[model samples]
Target chain A: MTGDAQTPALPLHLRAAILLRLLAIQGVWNYETMLGNGIAFAMEPALRRLPGGRQGEAYRTAMARHSGYFNAHPYLAAVAVGALIRAELDGVPAAQIDRFRTAAPGPLGSVGDRLIWAGWLPLCSSLALLAYGLGAGPLAVVLLFLLTYNFVHLGLRIWGLHAGWTQGLRVAQALANPLLRQGPAHVARATALVAGVALPVAAHALIGPGRVLLGSVLAAVAAGATLVTLLHGRFEGWRLATLALATFVLYTMVR
Target chain B: MGGDILFYVPLAVLGAVLGLDVVSFPQAMISRPIVASTLAGGLIGQPVRGLTMGVLLEFFALESLPFGASRYPEWGSAAVVGGSLFAAIPDGSAGAMSVAAFAALVTASIGSSSMVFLRRWNAIWARGQQRRIARGSGSAVVALQLAGLSADLIRGGVLTLVALVVFSPLNRAIVGTFSMSPVISRAVVVAVASAVGLAAIWKVVRTTAGARWWLAAGVGAGFIIAGTL
Candidate 1:
């Protein structure tokens, strides 16, 4: 809120640099604290560029601060990075910045996990898979997956940077904006629409019609319905594995 | 059996690069099963086989979320094995492709286990750098981070090399010996994969607004179109 309205804010090149580093958030995965070093790597450039409060001290302090047990869904980690940078520039205390770090991963992590990992990614990949099953070329299929996923991927990073820079801590609210809230549900719906149409078509493509085709269709529905329960019920993955074993048994008997 | 060093060396390089991209480096997501498998297939002059493998592998890949400290298979290297094995088979039979896919799945499992070791090594490396990192060692922080990155790169390359060395022959042997009705086998794979895709849809829609209505309309429209034509 204190910056010059006319100063054009953080330079385009710097934002680009920060985002580039963020792309490797899991580069240094560790069993004890996954991405611990990767967080320092991503934050180093921003800490250097923050432009206030004793640059060297800020650099060391920020690096030490972010290196402590930091983890989040990679795509939304930008929001945390942006907010931390904005806080440092605004002259917020080191202790408070640590508070911001603590505050960050919960909202951003959950939203990110739900939206990116569960929602947008599956939708795009499924769409690409459907296209592939329908006999699309590999490059075209890869292009589809990249274009769709990265549009949101890049857009969210850009939004997080600008919003965090401008709004500081308050940008956490923006993380829950309808785009994250409703956008995922909509993508999921669209995926269903695509899957609904593609399922039958792909069946015909992979298996010629007959009693076998009818059985495949029925099994597809049954497996889909069963998995809906497994996914929704919060059952462990092993349960699904067991169900899959059962499915294999049934598949053999039915055939 | 080893007649094509020319065929495999470049594929190994491709595997290394994509495997690194899975969790390190640019992460342009060329590492995802769909793209990586396709690229591996294209490299061996079998884009269709690659595309076919990519689509199948993608079903399992899509099931994973890969969020926050969670461990999951590194599909990038595994898909390379899959694309290459399927393309290697001269006839491109469905039954043969299924066996190749099984081998690739096993490779993916091994590759991910290797990745866990790399993660543990990263932790040790980072802890050693913590003192300098806290005391304003900018170079130290950068060095430690890069070390982690380099380790991941090496880990990926090694995993790819091992999977290829171990599985390539097994894929050939299994495909050569396995004999079954192509229709039944293809039906099983296609049905299971389609069911996985559908389950993903069902998970999303059931949670979203008016999910039931949307599901009804979608199925109704799809069937109507199918029945009419």
Candidate 2:
């Protein structure tokens, strides 16, 4: 609320710099601070605008404070960076900024994880796989995934930056906006639908219909395994697949 | 051997870039198994083979969430190794897919461990510069970030090269000696992968209201399409 409506937006070049730095925001991720260092790295460019510049007391205090432990999904972290920059420029108190910083990561992390990681990513990936399963060329499938996924990826980054800046200390209003609130549920539903279409198509592709009986047996086995996994708790598919293949390899070796 | 060296060196470099994409930079998800493996396969003029390997690997990769600092398989470089190993085979030999998958899974484990090491190393570097960082030293922060990126690049390159060198010949040997029928061996791999992928998707689908109905409709539509095909 302290952010002045009269405060001009950051210079385009500085905003560009922060956006570029955000790309590598997880570069130095660690247990103690998670993405804290990366956040500082992304924020540094914008902090250069503080009263004394990088050499100024204001800049130093903001840099050191922002460098402390913080974690959020990489893409949405742009919102946090944008808001923090706005806060610094508006001269928000360090203690209040600290409170916002601590509170921001949990929502950002959860929302981004659910939306991007679980929903949109799988949906696009399934669509691409579905295309490939139906006999699309490899280049086509790859292009489909990259183009579709990045469309949202780039858009979200740009939107987060703009939203966080304009909202500034009142950025929670941005988080509460309908897009963030309702987007995840809708995307998750679409993901489910796409995944269902993909599964049988991919199976049919891999197991040609020429051997109807064999394909049926394999399909049944897959279904059973899927059912068992669903009934059980967490889906550790990678680990299970690894073990199954490793055992198969060993059997071949022994024989 | 010379021919392999020529192929693997470039593949290793590609792995480095894609692996870095997993976390360090522009996470366009090109690091996904489907793309990474296909690229590896393209390197040897066997893009379809790479695609096949990639599809199976992609199924397993779907289970990974890549949440904040969570330990998950580094699929990018590992997929490159798997796809290259599978493509290297002269023919669609029995057990070839299985061996390549096994190699990929193992390499993913290695990549996973290497990531942990890189994080620790990054921590050490950051901790050493903590005083400067707390003092608001921009130069020190930049140095740490650059150093972290470089180390991750190196980790990915070395991991890919080592996996290729060790698994390539081993893969050939296993494929050559394997006695399982081609149909059955391939069926097992395909079955496990699809099942895992389906189940992983179902987990998410079941949680959201109305999603299950959408899924059922999609499945029915898929079968109708398959039937016509």
Candidate 3:
């Protein structure tokens, strides 16, 4: 706790380096170490300032320690990088640091998966699909997705770094922020509504007035099939659809 | 299929970058099907057609979470392959979307395996450097990271090249000799895609408390808009 005051702000260049390296933090992911290697790689720039410099014992120990098993959502992993760097610099006890690393990934992974992957991503995607349904140009739709999605993506990375560094071992506090806690549900609701709106609009646009009745019938059948598969819970509708496509293609080629 | 083979090189390159975006870097959903496919289509001066392929593929892609260490489809490179193949066909080809979707799904499965291979390869390489990494050698960590990235890039490129080379002609062959009526073939494809898409939306809607009503309302609104249109 006293380490918060003791931990000096990471220099601008070091912070920048950490940010850049965080981009590739999942590059070396493996079952053994998960994201351990990437965490060390991202944290190295900061660990350089440890008492002995890059070749110093402190730097080496911190690097090796961080290079052990770890995992987190790739985007939110920046928080771990920042917090770990601070903990190392603050000279938090070695045993405590390991515990922190172990405890951290759960919240980071769950929150990030819920907020970004499950909520924000689907929301943006359906919105883009909605735009396409409403006859938005291709470029416009793609741009809308990239621009809107990345706005929060970049902000999360930057905010995560700042929060992690400043809060050090207490960085879990950052995850508790209302935006992180409640964002997924709110986004999910919006996504459902948007997706519902988008599907029919897109269907109408694609099928045109002449085939409206046919399109509706097909949609109804497809929906029924999907619901049956969903009830089964083990199988995915897309996989079934893919199998059907392959079967159709093969049947046509052979016949 | 008749376009210069050289065209595939750049498309493969684009695939590598977008594929890298999948989990390696800047996961800016530019790797999403809509973006990846559109880019591939734009490369061939058929952005709209690419967009069409992208939307269909996006339905399938929604099932992917890209969550921790899960073996999910690599939509980025796959979408590029699908978009490019679909765009390459002359307009009004009944089987174009179907063939492209098939190709993309196949490519995605390949991408998933390649990712698993890359992780295994990385594990071996990382194990080899375990000593140095433990010694806190910055260079060792950097080497592992860079090597892993480079390998992923190559994997994506090769996946794209193989998909394009193999599926391009196959797509043309199937579309050229298609037996199904255009309306029926397309209707089936779109209906299936819609089903998968609706299922994806429903997966989320059902899990979230009280979201179904909003979805129902949205559906009603959608019908109104469709009626007006």
Candidate 4:
């Protein structure tokens, strides 16, 4: 609190470089380690204040936490890092980052946990499978997948970092602020939107043209109808089950 | 074992890369399932299958955001396993894809737990080397980083190899049993696909009520597009 306000902050390029390197401390090569590393990074400052006062304790803590976080939520960890780096650069105070580290975990974790684990992963992978079933090359599939995922991920990173540095946590707080009032629905919706776009793109690319298209169309209709019915409270587990059975039967007969 | 080695080597490499990326490198592009799995699938000469696996894996991976030392699954390795396994199977074998997906799912579950152990190990390693590291020696840093990456590589490689070895024969047996009945085979595929869908829906349903619609939209759109094609 006593430090000069005008103390030469880390240069933008240097900050970015440091951020990038810090991010690489564990690397995003895998989810488990990534979470551990991310958590470690997020908690680096706090770890520095711990009893040992070791020289590289912060980095080690960051690395460990990175693995921890990655294990729990790989995709969301990418976004959280985006937000964390932003908060750091903005000089919103290390305490704020700590608060976010504490507050954001459970809620965001819940939203992220459910969306990725239960919803998007299965859906997108299934579509990719459907495409493979149609015979697309591996390069094309990989390329497309990379393009779509990075589009969102890199975009979030850049956006989060920029906002955190320029607007500070005030901006991030504002963006995430609604969560406090609106609950987890907002995150769920955001996740759905992103996953929604991703799923069809992969499916369309994979399925190509043929009866596969027909089957997909029928499936879409049923899913849409089921969603609407559920929204209206008219959808029961039995009804949904029946719809699934019928869809399978129709697909079988037609194919 | 020949194909198994080929399959697992890439997965191990991917695990190493992703494990590094999680905290070591901020490349911010490769670790994603879409990219990782597709690459794996391509390496195996089945990009489409890899991509499909990536998409599904992406959903499951959506929640991963490393805020603190909390354990999460390594989708990068998991995707490689899922994609390669699915791609290895003959095209149009939905049943095979399902089994592969299940295999990957199980691997990821176990991987999540192993990550926790690695974290504690890393902490201990760091604490042990504190004095040397503080004195400007880079050995501790290098050792810690290497330890994480090496462990990940071993984990991914071993998991992929074992899962493929175990599941491939099981899949063959299952398919062989149902070979005569296209209905059963196709049914199995649909059932697996639905399970995947249900998993996704369950995630959406648990959080925001609104996500159910989005989930439906994605599924519906996918279904339509696939149908039209």
The backbone clash count of each candidate, in order, is: 0, 0, 0, 96
CA-based DockQ, model 3: 0.66
| lDDT for residue A183 in candidate 1, whole number 0-100 | 75
Find the candidate with the highest DockQ and give its number.
Answer: 2
- Tens digit of per-residue lDDT, candidate 4, span A1-255: 212234334356644653453444453233233344434443343234333443464434443333343343444443455455444333345566666665555544554444444433333444444444345565655555455545544554455444434443344353464432353455456555544544544434433332233355436534653453354333333224334433443454355
CAPRI quality band, candidate 2: medium
Provide the lowest-lDDT 10-residue window in model 2 chain A: A208-217
- List ranges where model 4 is wrong by over 4 Å: A1-9, A25-141, A155-187, A190-255, B1-11, B18-34, B52-73, B92-95, B130-146, B162-183, B205-227
Candidate 3, residue B139: the lDDT equals 92
For model 2, the superposed segments whose C-alpha errors exceed 4 Å read A208-224, A227-235, B1-6
TM-score of chain B of 2: 0.95
After the best TM-score superposition of candidate 3, give how far the Cα of residue A46 lies from its true spot, in angstroms.
1.0
DockQ of each: 0.45, 0.68, 0.66, 0.22
lDDT against the true structure, each candidate: 0.69, 0.84, 0.84, 0.50
lDDT of 4 by residue, B1-229 (tens): 1444564665566665654444345545466676777777777777766776666555445434343455556656667777777777776653554455555666666666666666566666656655654443334445555665566556555655566666567656554443323334333333333333344444445556667687668656654554454
- Chain B TM-score by candidate, in order shown: 0.87, 0.95, 0.96, 0.71
**Which ranges of candidate 1 are over 4 A from the true structure?**
A1-8, A49-55, A208-255, B1-7, B92-94, B212-229
Chain A superposition TM-score per model:
0.78, 0.92, 0.90, 0.43
Which pairs of residues collide in model 2? none
